[model samples]
Target: MEFNLTWILLGLPVAFVLGWLASRWDLRQVRADNRQAPKAYFKGLNFLLNEQQDKAIDAFIEAVQNDPDTSELHFALGNLFRRRGEYNRAVRVHEHLLSRGDLSRSDRDRAQHALAHDFLKAGLLDRAEDALRRLEGTAFEAEARLALLAIYERSRDWGQAAAIAGKMQQAGQGDFSTRLAHYLCEDAQTRMAQGQFDAARKLLEQALATAPQAPRPLLELAQLQQRCAQPAQALDTLENLARQAPASLPLAATLLVDVAQATGQQARVQGLLETQYRQAPSLDLLQALVALDQHIGVPDAPGRARLVQHLDHEPSLVAAAQWLQGETLAEEQYHPAVQKALDHAAKPLTRYRCAACGFEARQHFWHCPGCQSWDSYPARRVEEL
Candidate 1:
């Protein structure tokens, strides 16, 4: 029994020493792994600071492989892939992060946003839309909704766009009255095309009610009135537009001329356009004035003189071109060549340019086709602007 007791005492110390050694070995392994993680992370950061994104991505991937629990490393790699336009790989990385159970709620939301961005960059709009929709109710809700708004606009789903805009407006994002009115007007146009005139009129009326000062609805209503052969009503609507949205009168100037000529209200129409022109002189408004006078049998000399007066005020290439169209050039032989050159030069200047993206178009746009911004184009032509 004594011998057994002596052996037990000796074995206890040996076991204690062995346990301490095992713990030290484990601690060393953990410390080494922790140290390696930071080292790899710093290496990636160094590459990133040098703008070597490819190498940075490689290092970050290595870091993620070693420390699979590190969500930050995964995020970095995913973002790197996205920046490099490797959307598929970025999507894979973010999707893998989302699949991990260890990710926190915020991290999950971030991963979801990243994944959506990847899908968007890859032109996988359907996938992006699905991913973005999942972000609703989270902190990413506003951002997601904004992206969805843009997506809906791109798809020309005016109904969905209006719904999203309504939500954003409710959330105090910004005033979307004008945007909503535009959507209603677009729907009204579609309904009119489908021969649903009453429905179209109702929608346009709703648009005007939504934004009292908005010119588009009144202009559209006037157009609808003209279409239905209600020339007097169209003229009244345009006159109201001139009072309510004077700055946008140029957009509806041609319509005003048509309605006035139809109703034989040339004198009243000329006064309205002239008043607008005096306030905000635009080439369109001037042209409308010239047309009105010509329609009422004004002499050719007076019309030519009006063009000269506009050129003096605005110094516009377009006005000068118009004036020259009727004038006999001093060098009659070279007149055709000079006129052709002037027309060529004025052609670009005559285009309406988007204020947001500088995309020039032959016709004015309420919404820019290139940038997809509402009311991005100024009513004035490029030369006037």
Candidate 2:
């Protein structure tokens, strides 16, 4: 039963050889599996680059199947699905990623973000909001807050919008004071509609305090004052607006005329309008001045005469059209047709246009309906722009 040294040595080498061969075989199998995943991934990338989205999606799906545990592949597939507007599939991929216990904190946040976007794209706002709320204190917090802000704005939930905007402002994400003011003004309008005059006035005052230089709050507050039959207060508010933002006079010019007539401050408002017109000649200012003159019965000129003077100063088609309306033409029959044509041409010119999206409306908008941008529309009319 004594052990043979020669046999023992020979068995040792044989065992070593077998183990080496086994390791090499396992390595080749691993390489073969990796090769399939990589090939599919590359094919997906190629298809994507070629703008063949359907083929790209198929290739990515194949890649994901080959490498089921690969986090990067899962992320890629989810993003691709989202891009293709397949929110359900995208949500499934991201949810699967979240279910994996091996995922890092950052990767989990990323998956969560992807899932939120999936919900958002699918128009599941309630779920999307919940998902987005979870991203707070994560890297995507700022983005999520902005998304929530947009949702609030779309829903006309001014209070929620204001809250988000305030957070963003406090975070130094960007200047949201003007946006905050707009939110307050919007809420004030709602209150005014509800016959909560005092509440609306307080909100507008808060808006003015929130952004003193913003023109909307001042103008809105004055309008509310005029509605409350506090014409003197409204006139004072408008005068403050003029002093603060002289360039925004056109927006307040009509309001000023109304307040002036109400408060018997036509002479004072005429001085302000004349001063503003001297600084920047706007059709609105000219019109306001002419109206004031007509109200006070200025001995210098009639409204038509003032329009003519504006024509001399600016050579405006709008001015000419206004002046022509009151004048008696030599061919009275042709006057109606000429006036009709002029009115038609001048109609579009009176509209306010958004600087951001070129959305034209008869009334000016603080927020652009087309592009959802705030302060996009200028105070001046389309013709002035």
Candidate 3:
């Protein structure tokens, strides 16, 4: 066929015009679809802002159905379901996302994390543990490990908790030495209850080695030694505690007094407690000092004098009550009732309070029952605080 320049020129413009029209049609269709998806999404957002979760869920479901391939929508819908306590639906949505081969690596990790959260909120601990463990080398590793630690702690699996804590420490998540020591202490307590004294002692020693600055291990070790009829060893442990962690001496005060009496070292312990009291006065230390003095043949007058001295330093009601208990009041007939009232008023001051959750207990707790925080209770009593 012979080439026709005129026809060729005409055909080029016609093809161009058709191509432009087709492109415009596709663009308009895409805009319409985008607009429809956002309209439902905005409606969901409005419902969520109004605190109408049910309506928000319905709107989000409609949006997800309209845009099934949208990863963001799937994530939003799954989070809403989980928040509404609809774990099964949330699991299905995240599982559907995970099942897609087209999902990016980051989105896949995100979906896995969401699924783990769903299982955790549903109280399916075993399922949650498995799901979290799969996230081990991902960006969510630290968070997953923390969740696993909590699960292990809730189950009273101290060994698993220690393992997770050790991993977190190695990852530079935070200094978990104190937490690890607490886990060891918990395990040792269980061992002690089972009459496994040797195992308990070894665990406590390991805890001391793990966190030398942490007072719990030292205190627990001293108690364990005393229980094992090794008061001399217990006294040595408390002396090391006084030297290394003097700030924690108040918490170990009663134990110190008991050990000192048991080992016939009351005079030496009395001097140590007096020195600690001079540096940082605490009601517990004062009580320990008085007990020690009384054991070493000190008169009631001098022992009561220590409480008066404490009052001069810290205006403590607990100290005043202790002082009055030994005083000979002029109205001897009313002394008993007056002393009873003072003791009752000072009782709460002697209790230990959790720093994290304001939980008051008669004894110090390494782990707070109210907030599940480790080492949350300060060494001092409520009065000292």
Query: What is the C-alpha local distance difference test score of candidate 2?
Result: 0.91
Ranking by TM-score: 1, 2, 3
How many residue-pair clashes does candidate 2 contain? 0
Q: Among these predicted structures, which one has the highest TM-score?
A: 1
User: Poorest 10 consecutive residues of model 2 by lDDT?
Assistant: 297-306
Residues 113-189 of candidate 1 have per-residue lDDT tens digits of 99999999999999999999999999999999999999998988999999999999999999999999999998999
What are the RMSD figures for all models against the true structure? 2.4, 3.4, 5.5
lDDT string for model 3 (326-366, tens) is: 77889899989998998999999989999888999998888
Expressed as tens digits, the lDDT of each residue in 1-385 for candidate 2 is 9878999888999999999999999999999989999999999999999989899889989988989988998998898898999999999999999999999999999999989999999999889999999999999999999999988988899989999998998999999998999999999999999999999999988988999999999999999999999999998888898899998879989999999999998889999999989899999999998888888977645777878878887868888888887788898999999999999999899999988878899998889999899989888877777
Clashes of each: 0, 0, 0
Segments in model 2 whose C-alpha atoms lie over 4 Å from true places: 1-27, 299-301
Which should have the higher TM-score, number 2 or number 3? 2
